[model samples]
Target: MKLSRHSDYALRIMIQLATSGDALVSIRRIAETYGISHTHLMKIVQSLGRAGFIETVRGRHGGLRLARPAQDISLGALVRHTEGEDGLVDCAGCLIAPACGLPSILAEALEAFLKVLDSYRLSDIASRGRMLRALFDISVPTNP
Candidate 1:
């Protein structure tokens, strides 16, 4: 299943912050590092912030950081937050909507997909902290 670019960016931002530890990361730097639009990334960041995944600090010295530990952030939870409750198919307009089994089958597929994601925390996916930091030119936590 393909996730929206918005969800994709949110996950990337989370991973970046997870690897940074307590360090505040600038949105501009993250955008540049990922070759993504700053404006686009800003919107994703705002959504993640609203969902309580990340915290925004205001001030000249302020930036963004994870609101909680990486281990507490589940991939399935993040996907749900970003994707909302929209169904995979719009059977409302289909002629066979009343008896079609496609919707139920698709729903089962989605459930299985999310079940796999639910098994992993951000910590599991962000295990390559040093590698990610090096690729982004950010300093890796010596103690991590």
Candidate 2:
């Protein structure tokens, strides 16, 4: 199944936050880094915040961070939140809607796909924190 741009951005946002450690990341920074629209990224950020995936801080020094640890955030759950309950095929108005076996087949395929994602957590993908930070041009904090 193809993922929406919204889901794609959401995953990117999660990865950014995961790689940042405890630092708060701004929407503008993320938008610029990904070369995506700032306005569009804000909407996605709001959706992720509402879904409890990330937390949004207000006022000066404000930005975004994960609501919980990366290890606790499941990839399948994030995709589900962003993808919604819509099925792969919209057979509602089709003449073969009632007779088609394609819907069931697609549903099974989707389930299998999601099951694979379920096996991974955000931490699993964001394990290369140092490399990700460097790639994003984010400064790595010094240990003192």
Candidate 3:
């Protein structure tokens, strides 16, 4: 099943945060990097913050960071939070809804899909920190 843009954006946001180390990232910066709507991202940020995935710091030097370590954030959990419990297809209006087995099959497929996601964490995807930072034009201090 195709994931919603909301889920996609949320994941991107998480990855961006994951690769940024301890530095706080601004929503505008993320939006500019992804070429997404700043207003739309604000909503997603609010949702993520409310769900305890990311922490938002307010002020001039303030920005955003993960609420916990990247390894502690499960992709499956993030997807679930962003996508909610909605089924892949809305078979409710179908005439054969009562007898159709598609819903169950889709449910199983979604479970399997999420199971794969569950096996991964934010750190897994953001492991290529140097590459990601370079790609995003983010600069992190190197150890001497």
Clashing pairs in 2: none
The residue ranges of model 1 lying beyond 4 angstroms of the native Cα positions read none
Q: CA lDDT of each candidate?
A: 0.91, 0.93, 0.94
Q: In lDDT terms, how accurate is model 3?
A: 0.94
After superposition, the stretches of candidate 3 with alpha carbons farther than 4 Å from their true spots are: none
- Which residue runs of candidate 2 sit more than 4 Å off their true CA positions? 141-144
- Counting only residues 3 or more apart in sequence or on different chains, how many pairs clash (N, Cα, C under 3 Å) in candidate 2? 0
lDDT tens per residue, model 3, 64-98: 99999999999999999999989898987799999
Lowest summed-lDDT stretch of 10 residues in model 3?
A: 135-144
What shift in Å separates residue 121 of candidate 2 from its native position after superposition? 0.4
Q: State the weakest 10-residue window (summed lDDT) of model 2.
A: 135-144
